[model samples]
Target: MKEAENRACEVMLHAGLLPQLATMETIAAAAGPVLEPFVQYLLRHISTPRGVDGVSPFELNAALANALIEGEEALTGLVSLAVSIVPLAPAAATTNSSSLTAATSGGVCSVSSLTRVRLTLHPAYPLNLIATDSFLNLHTMLWTLSLQLQWVAQSLIAARVCLWKESQSQKRSGTDNNTTFSTTTAPSTRAVQQEMLHLVHAVRQHMLTHVENTSVRMRRGIATCGSLREMQKQCGEYEEELRHGCLLHDTSSSQLGSRKWHNHNDGPAASASGSPELHSSLLEVLESSLRHCILLGHARQAKILINKAKQAQLEAEDAEQEALALDSLEFAKQKFSQITCAVAATEREFEGHRVAFMERVSVYGSEAGAHSDAARALLAAVDIQGRWQPQKGT
Candidate 1:
């Protein structure tokens, strides 16, 4: 905007149009055609960093950074957990005398290894445009963004023209009424001019700030731009991502060793004590009770036999609980795979918007300013009607 404004000022000065003769109509007509390119430049500087239409994955997916950090911690926890727990099998004691597993209160634990490992991505939200990365979807978004920004720029240009018109109106009326838009109505003219200038600066600054922020995954330390507060947030999230970063990753991973093949275990009810061998166990208890009941008529030892069976049942339950923990890990692995694809698709769409933005910024920046000298000259000849503004040399 500054660049274009400077160039337009130069064109008017060089044309030698009588300054007093330059009416609002003449100025508008002179600048109209030349200002179109500047409008585009300003819009790109304003809207590109916000997202193609203000929905950016980088902005949307801050949870991915936390997920990444805690995820490593969770993984570290899992490893420590496995090492601490997985060796209570009675077979482990017999198989390796050198094993250092803690003694189980239950005679044995059925879970004997790290049966699974799973990952989970964070902040799983449901979305409407699930297939947002498709080329059709991406391009349509860019088209919408272009139209929105263009409308804003056009409205601003129209406002500048109206301000100029109102300035001319004041000169004609010679009313010290101190009006703004018309001879009768009023607003702060200086405020309007100052705001317009500040607005252009804001557009350029907004674009640059976000451009740096979006690179959180790539840059490090002071290279990534953000406020002091954001830098603090970046410390943990940023460090973990860099530590885990592998640039060339293969997305076609078939599995994560999350489940044991053909090892389907029965439910807790059956595993703990619901077997039809239940009949034999019950029969044994009944016989022992009968034999002791007679002695209880004379005080027999039936309670001791029943207590032994109860102890065995408690051990089976402990084993069942450990197996469920391993199963939970496997489920986590499944969730990770599903969410990874979704995240990738989103990031790809974000890249598309950025690329579209950069292509435009590059093209506009290639030229120093709008080429409007010819247009201004034509309008001057028509409006000023041969009244030559005196040249410095003349």
Candidate 2:
């Protein structure tokens, strides 16, 4: 919901519309005119999990979906949250004894409860597997979720660029009605972008941690379960099994049911991503972010062109209006003479315009220099991300 709202906000920005109230309902109303008080009344009492924490709603959804794949419930492709509990660790038990006693007796406010982990279980995995399979599998899908979201972002931004360019072309050719556009970037635009990027990187850090942890867990599981006599090629196959909710097998000349799951720590991605288990999750995230930024830059360029061309159209219209006042042949001949004289004015001003543009670029470096640098950095990163993938198989 947050991601979708942000994209809608950007589209509204592109269309010279500002989000009023800056609520989800305000920003996401780019699709059409929003019905007023009725819509407000309906959404007034609505709330979503972690909605106030600025956490991407995708995180919870993805976490839940990943949790589903670990057991029998996955066969039905259905799962729901089970009973939740707060288990006090031994260390906290003594410190919170009085509060624990009060809570056990009074059924309220336990100091120990606040300090302990809130255990949320799904039917797919039991509490026993929390330290083993469930923990490892829980956060792995975050990487996939981020990449897919970023891919969608890139597509939307690219679409904006195409639409803007096409509109500009039609306007310039006098084939469409012209609308005024602003070249100025919004003050809050960078804030929104940075906020989104921060959430993304937060997700990426979790992805990295889970990938490494899961690879270790997979290795231990493999060693204990006796999946095969040999250790080679287990990680890749195991990750595949995890993905498909299938039995772990020895892909190397035989099959063994010794282990229920396997790890692809040895798969071809990189040590950076821990295993093929990660599918180069970190790299994919970085690439997706970079791609999104590049597409945004393309859209911005198209927007700039749209705004700057308005000057030429205005000038042509003013010239045509002046020419329309020529009621006499004498007046017309004099106007024609003036037009002939001004024919070379554009050629003469070309160098001046180039110099002025260069000056503006220099000023841009000092003014919005941070934004420009960030954009260039993103583009450079995109280049790197694009360079590596083709050399190896995903």
* Reference-based TM-score of each model: 0.20, 0.26
Q: Among these predicted structures, which one has the highest lDDT?
A: 2
Candidate 2 per-residue lDDT over residues 214-268, each given as its tens digit: 4555555534332222222444443543332111111210011011111222223
The global C-alpha lDDT for each of the candidates, from Candidate 1 onward, is 0.27, 0.30
Model 2 vs. true fold: TM:
0.26
**Candidate 1, which ten residues in sequence have the lowest lDDT sum?**
245-254
Candidate 2 residue-wise lDDT at 83:
17
Q: Compared with the true structure, what per-residue lDDT tens digits does model 1 show for residues 348-376?
A: 33233222222222222232322122212
Best by TM-score: 2
**In candidate 1, which residue ranges exceed 4 Å CA deviation?**
1-150, 173-204, 212-394
